[model samples]
Target: MSNSLFQPITLGHLTLKNRIVMPPMTRSRASQPGDVANELMATYYAQRAGAGLIVSEGTQISPLGKGYAWTPGIYTPAQIAGWRQVTDAVHREGGVMFVQLWHVGRVTNPDNTGGAQPISASAVKAENVKVFVDNGTDAPGFVDVVAPREMTKADIQQVIAEYRQSALNAIEAGFDGIELHAANGYLINQFIDSESNHRTDEYGGSLENRLRFLDEVVGALVNAIGAERVGVRLAPFTTLNGTVDADPQTTYTAAAALLNRHKIVYLHIAEVDWDDAPDTPMTFKQAIRAQFDGVLIYAGRYFTQQDQAAKAELAIASGLADMIGFGRPFVANPDLPVRLAQGFPVATHDPDTLFGGGEKGLTDYPVYQAAK
Candidate 1:
């Protein structure tokens, strides 16, 4: 039997070496003061360059778009230059990379946004959600998110412009493409999901109105960077960060069809991965494929070299997804593709050192050593 996950595949114009992807995971280790990507970030990504594609951590599009301390931004010239080094390192190791552009919307505290009120499609506050922020101490802390102000026509237009500029900045930084961070109850999710948005204007209430911000931002990105270089990540059945759509199936199917019209490169679905989390129904997967013709990538809990590995292979063999993303597995195994192909045992990452740390848990994980 052919090793389906080890085969080469075409993504946009680039050919990927395998069907394995290293999806975006925030380490919160960017340079202090500027939230810029640095040599450490570069080295971390380069260590995991064995994947077919590498989607970077959530990079805020503007200072005001920030939601966490120590996360990188893509708007400033220094930030762009910082990302260039990271991309150059990834390219040196023959890896394809895409930067995930992000805006937190109401998923932020005032401290993370320079004390400016966070803006969203509506002024509703996220319930029981907290964002990481600098607490005037060496270690950052999490604080409850404040209710965001409703975005005006001008605010919406300005944010769209920022997304366009950030897309251009990613291209200038040498990324193969860009992925809009529309998942995990961020800014875009704030608009697409019904529960968070309470506006009564043209940008709210009806499904189409709620989706208008997403449509406009996507259109701006597609116009700034070619549709072939654009991608969007959606969390269909997740209520993470308090984003629960009244009807997720209908919402996401329509989202897929909308992206299809733009001719974007891919539509990445972030399936709920936590223990006891409900699996995304196969029927919904079929519905998404029916609407979107581009490449599909699914991430979350697809383990390496075990029953889950077989499940990953089955997903590809059955045409459910073109590529499979192994998040936590790749964090501990840099040579993940080789290990997956050889049936090597995967290592566990340190949960204590998962975020806001240096090389200890980030780049210190070693490759699997086979028995001689």
Candidate 2:
């Protein structure tokens, strides 16, 4: 059978050697004191530079955007300098990297935000959701998320400016592009989903109104960076962090149509992967394809080597997706694209050290070595 996963595809100005992507996965391993990116994080990404596109772990756009402890940010000068190390390392290995701009919105605790309350499109709380907070211990585990204050118009405009600034910061850090973290019940997703947004303003109520926040942010990013270098991640059917829309199919299909107007480089769909998670319907997929003309990327659980290959082949062959992203698999296998192409065995990841750790599970995963 023909393998399309290894074929080169052009996404706007960047041409990827393969269809495999390293999606953003927060590891919370940034150097402390300011949540700045560090050498260890740079080493971690450089080790996985074989991926066609490496979307860096979700880096907060500003200090107020942070939801978890130790995750890197792109707002500070030190953070930008630190991320430059990561981008330079990746570039040395002939890899293209995009920093993911993120804001947790209501999915945060005051303990994590220096006594400041979290803000979202609405004041609604994400029930039963928990975020990691440092308690000055070896393991600063999960704590209940706090209810957030409704974002005033001023707050919304400020965040838009911050996002634009963050995009500029990403460029200063030497990143090739940037991805907006608008998925999985984060700040942007909070505004997009009706369940979370209860405001009477123009940013809520109707679908178009709810999408206003996303439109403004994307527009700002496109203005800061070019549209060719910007991408947005969306989780249409995901209930993660209590983000759910009344009509996901209608909502996301409309979203895809709106994004087409901006002519972004790509639209990354974070399909549900958990056990018993709902599968994305074929009709919905077709709707997205019909509406958006840019590159499409899908990420979920493609468990085995065969599964990964088959998914990539089918998606690419059918023109359903331009790229396939593997999250946890990339965590354990830095040279994931090579191992998949060669049918090499993939190592299982350690769940205990998946987040908030040092070299144990971060950069310690060795590349594939042939038996001598």
Candidate 3:
């Protein structure tokens, strides 16, 4: 049976060549001291241009938004120029790319934020979680997260402005679109999830209030770069980085409905991918599909690492997802679309060089070669 994964789909003004998406996976390889994107990053993205659509790694909107050391940023002129190199490289290879805009609310400590206390929906600490920072050594350093200061109304407005500017910056950097990092317990996730958000203001408390920040941010992005070029990612089931909504179905279903109102280009759902992770209910998937009318992308352990092609095909065939994002597989198999379409064996990536590194595991992955 032929797979629907290779079918071309229209998203906004662009027609994607296929449904295979390379979802954003953070690799802390940005130029240090300035966190700028460079030729190395460009080479990495251009190598994976086989993907129908590529979402760049999580990029901080401002210095304060940074959580991990060496991750790229979009706020500075040098950073924007750096990303231009990446976008230009990807474009040269005929790939469509969207930058993932991020802000790690309470997911950081003073070390990563230049001595500034991390800010969140409330003064809460993400227990049992550690973010990576530069230890001024060869190896990346991990430290416990400190309790964040409750964001003031002024602070919230400023962050929203930063997001708006970041979207504009993305366009200037030559990206086709932008994806708001509203998932994975980031800044936006910090506000959306019930467990982490303990606020009485309009940005929290009630379900509608909890969704206000998301609404504002999406509106800002849409206004800055049009709704057709905007996308959002949500993690409804995972308690990653200490974001736990009391009722995920109710919460995320409402969230889907909210994105529908914005009419964003797509809604990406990041499912829990760890081994032994609970399956995301079909009912919830159906609910989200029902709520959001645009393109729907589902990523994360869709079966097993090796069986991604089979499971991803099944997902698109089931009508629940319009596209599939292969994260780790894309890392090890730069020619992932060709390999999956032709049933070539995929290569496994090295866990050691996954994060902060040079070209070893980054762009060294080769295209599959069949036995002659």
Top model by lDDT, which number? 3
The 10-residue segment of model 3 with minimum total lDDT is 302-311
How well does each candidate superpose onto the true structure, as a TM-score?
A: 0.98, 0.98, 0.98
Worst 10 residues of 1 by lDDT: 301-310
* True lDDT of residue 309, candidate 1: 77
How does residue 94 of candidate 3 score in lDDT? 97
When sorted by TM-score, best at the front, the candidate numbers are: 3, 2, 1
Q: What TM-score would candidate 2 get against the native?
A: 0.98
Writing each residue's lDDT as its tens digit, candidate 3 over 1-372 gives: 267999999999999999989999999999987999999999999999988899999999998999998999999999999999999999999999999999999998789889999999999899999989898874689999999999999999999999999999999999999999999998899999999999998999999999999999999999999999999999999999999999999999999999999999999999999988898999999999899999999999863545657888888999999999989988889898898888778788899988887888898888888999
- List ranges where model 2 is wrong by over 4 Å: 305-308
Candidate 1, 171-225: lDDT as tens digits: 9999999999999999999989999888888888988988888899999999998
lDDT of each: 0.90, 0.91, 0.93
Clashing pairs in 3: none
> Which portions of model 1 miss their true places by more than 4 Å?
136-138
Which sequence of candidate numbers ranks them by lDDT, best first?
A: 3, 2, 1
Model 3 CA lDDT for position 57? 98
Cα lDDT of model 2 overall? 0.91
